[model samples]
Target: MKGRTKLTGLVIFRGDPGYEAARKNWDPHTDRFPKVFVFAQRTQDVSNAIKWARENKVPIRPRSGRHSLEVNLSQVNGGLVIDTTKLNQIKLNKKAGTVVVGTGNRVGRIANTLAKQGFIAPFGDSPTVGIGGITPGGGIGPLQRSIGLISDNLLALEMVDAKGKVIRANSKCNSDLLWATRGGGGGNFGVYTKYKFKVHPAPAKATVYRITWPWAQFEEVLKAWQRWAPFVNNKLGSELSIGPKKGGNVSMEGLFLGSKTEALRLLKPVTSVGTPTSSIIRLLPYTEAVKFLLPPDPILTQRESNQFSSGFGRKPFTNKAIKAMRQFLENVEGQFAGFFFLNWGGAVSRKSPRSTAFYWRDAQFYVEWNSSWLKPSAAPRNIAIVRQTRRKLQPYIVGSYINVPDQGIKNSGPVYYGANFPRLRRVKAKYDPKNIFNNPQSIPPANHKR
Candidate 1:
């Protein structure tokens, strides 16, 4: 460690004033009391933190936006958490039609930033999700079908390797590393600092729509949506949510990259089925549409306990499958329980499966469900509800999304990366041979089989 980079950022030891707040993640259930937290202000700070952690023989975790959903993914007991929230810097190249952004930026910030420039970038539903985490796992949202996953737009990235050396990856250099980072999942190879993304010019105005139905109409509405959503015009992207009978209702919300007339016409299939309790459609500026589609930016300090599971639907759900879903929803006791579906064709499926580490390109739709609770006592039942639902729907689902990690899934490497797992392992070997960066489900170097 003779040439080790000294820790140069805001380093907070366990007993520091902000240690309690710095150690918390988006979900309270996954938070842990780390030995130290380093809020990285620059790339060198990240490198120094990695070297400092190694010098002290402490586990290391890279965190941004603190939105990691699973335990130990972003924070660990007695570990070093390298926080990147302060590295948020946005540089737009209008001439090249691209943007180079710090990985620490959140989804909502990027959306709002790009919108102000009259450009748009793909983003997920949650405004608080960090780009550093989501982009690697194939970021999905309303713009997926229209603009492709955030990873698909990725052009280059800068990362600090296991040895605390800064490196750049793109199509020209360290190409394999670039390929893996596209969809191979974060915390596998290195800690990303900056990302160069191919951005799209935004249309002046777009249509945003929301349709709701009584909870009893879940079956009919779901059937209609599944049949129509994936095959609809690529310009339109939609999501359907089926909530628990206790405190939920069926609803569909989407953004159409066109006028209200065309959007309503394309939505006829689902809109014609169940007698919707209410329907609202409006044409608004692209920036406003983003605000309308996404939930409000979450308070960074706010925390909750929750269990989440994810999967891909290769084909439409059969009656048995639909019945199973309904049964699970009916039996779930929590008010914060529901299933979310996103149509998954269009630009997402245009690329070959092997093009990037993301391999679920052929899926027709994506589905995920969550069971959340405020009390620690409710953990068991809530976790069981999600696990049981996954078991019942296992036959109809294919792979799981790495971003939405589910600890219950055995042999998750294949479930998340499919055939690309081997290549990802090789990349891991090349970039992090000793596996300096690792988590519960992180890929092992190729020579060391799991």
Candidate 2:
């Protein structure tokens, strides 16, 4: 392990020329330096890294896109980092309606690559998000309402477990592992190497729409959206973002798996509530539509920093809760703060809670409280805004979304897994009893506490 000449992938030690660059995370806020960085080129390299860490009595962290909000969960000081970004390989079984993707593949790349072959898989809005991180946490995207979460379509996957053993999980074998992976979130069971997902034929064409209302009308819009978006139509998926009233605005945007006319007809309820300041509606090919939904940092080649907390709403917001939300948006101390409501019903609710580890299947929509800052001194105020908003909406929300990891949350085990927490603990004990794959928020073994 000293020279790393026998390792398949390049290994960098502290003070190495490239170590500084390799240790940085996608989030600028995450400042952690590992003793060694392994840019794993193949599945075997991941196993080697884990084995090396165990032998050396050093902790190890597995990383792919490096987008975890709680960055420390995927990184540790003076430990070993197993980076799987170089394991990117995609194989398509077009006839079987399936695609095998490497864990390092990004969401945007996955969409574009599969669309070319007239097939696609459900993925989140961020083009830079790694399939490895999102799939295990229940990937929600534009097509989610119509099809289902990315986890719902996961057919099989390969992983390097805590014992350095490569294992495959699917319906026929290691089914319990498969059940735990779907919506159980990452950094729990093991390091995922590859995922084979059941794909659907790309929609010939899709429509996208964006509508904005003045800050003064934010309350009205929120009320209407909460009552409508989730149940609007199976073919339409939408999200509402309401920025701080102090220098921010409110907007709604989403994609529809139908023609422009159909999208317009279904959007009448939203458009009728208030006169929008601006509106843009377009019909484009499936791939183009998917690309349009990409986040600000589409490729994630650069670092972005932010803080946020998310939860699921089983029912519409109460009038009191809506007022609290409006008051918080209007009076929040920070300027770069907002609340997001993402549609979350249709096919998502069709599955029972126990079918998969994803616990909030019956939720109508999910809520995310977000805040950002430019300086360390400015972080606390912005962070407070997010926590306060969560407190305001606490009574109306259920479990939290594991995808948006939040360190501020207490009782994370129950909040993230709900009734499935117990089963997830069992899975953790089975595959990672020694807790080689772990983090502050990671699922613990049968009797351990968070």
Candidate 3:
């Protein structure tokens, strides 16, 4: 492995120009530099990278999207990166409501392509996010409650393990592999190349709504909305995003899945909370509604958004919790922070948690606190805010969605996976006993040494 030809499949060493861009994800706060990167175009390429790194006794860090907040990439400083963005390929069987896509494929491409066939994959909130990272990590979105988490639709997977063996896993084959990949989160096992998943007949037409609440009513609306959210009908979905408004005000951003007429009827409690300064709700294609919550256009956003770890609440946030949220909001500077409450409980939780590796099966609400700032100097404060919020909400968290990982700083594996920790650890021990795939928040094997 001394010269260029000595290494395997599409290697780029320390000086390669592509190495810089290939090493980083979208999170601007991280500063990681791996020894080399393999712009793998096929499974063999991924295998080669893994084999080379392991033989040399170097750790391997896998990156798919630009969304990983944790420093998973940073660990590759003297190791290797199996860059799979080039392995993108989508094999669709539209009639069967199924798709076999390369893990590198983004949510936007999947959604747009599926739209043509009158079917659609549950795209991640961001168009740029890669399926490799999201599908395995348990994705959430407007369509999540309506259809289900992206992992719920996963039917099979093609993976390259730490041993560099190419294996295909499905229910009839490697069922344990399928279960671990669904929600065990990334880097706990190996690199996933492709995924076989179930798609849904998307609504021919859909609707979206945007409502802004006045700053003065933040406390009242925050508490009441959480209570009203879990009780809403299965077909309807709403999110109460609380953020500082212009001129030091506060706002609530929402998304609903129905016509203006029906949406109004369903959102009466929300409308009654505060006199919306700006109210806009209208019908559109299912595609359009999906895009509403995740606009491509840049708006006022936190620059250095910190880690977002989430958990499910059994009931609406209590008065004490609501007051704490309000107090936190009161302290956050208008320019750089916000707390988001995505309402849940729909067709999603109707199924048992045991159905998938994802443990938050009975959760009614999802909470994410993000601190957004424009400068590099802002990261410490942002990270602190996220930590404080997690401490405050610890009691209310029943189970967690793995994708929104807080890296390696959590109290214990039990804090993240609830009752599923023991099982997940067992699965880790069984499949990745060598611990070839590990990062900050990954599940350690039963016989873990460090």
Give the residue spans of candidate 3 off by over 4 A. Answer: 2-10, 73-75, 245-257, 297-305, 334-336, 408-411
Minimal lDDT window, size 10, model 1: 295-304
| 1 versus 2: better TM-score goes to | 1
In the range 1-450, model 1's lDDT, one tens digit per residue, is: 244557789989989899887877778899899988899999999999999889888899999878788899999999989988898999999999999999899988999889878998888878889999999999999889988889999999999999999999999999998899889999999899999999999999999999999999999899889999999999998999988988799999989999999998999999999789999999999999988886686576554577999999988999988888888888776665789999998999999999999999999999999887788998888898889889999999999999999998988999999999999999999999999999999999999968
Clashing pairs in 3: 26-66, 245-249, 302-372, 303-373
Q: Determine which window of 10 residues in candidate 3 has minimal summed lDDT.
A: 297-306
Q: Rank the models by TM-score, top first.
A: 1, 2, 3
TM-score of 3: 0.92
User: What ordering of candidates by lDDT runs from best to worst?
Assistant: 1, 2, 3
Question: What's model 1's TM-score?
Answer: 0.98
lDDT by residue (35-86, candidate 3, tens digit) is 8878788888888788788878778977776667666543457778777778
List the pairs of residues colliding in candidate 1.
none
Q: lDDT scores for all predictions?
A: 0.90, 0.84, 0.73
* lDDT accuracy of residue 103 in candidate 1: 88
Error of 1 at 239 (Å): 0.7
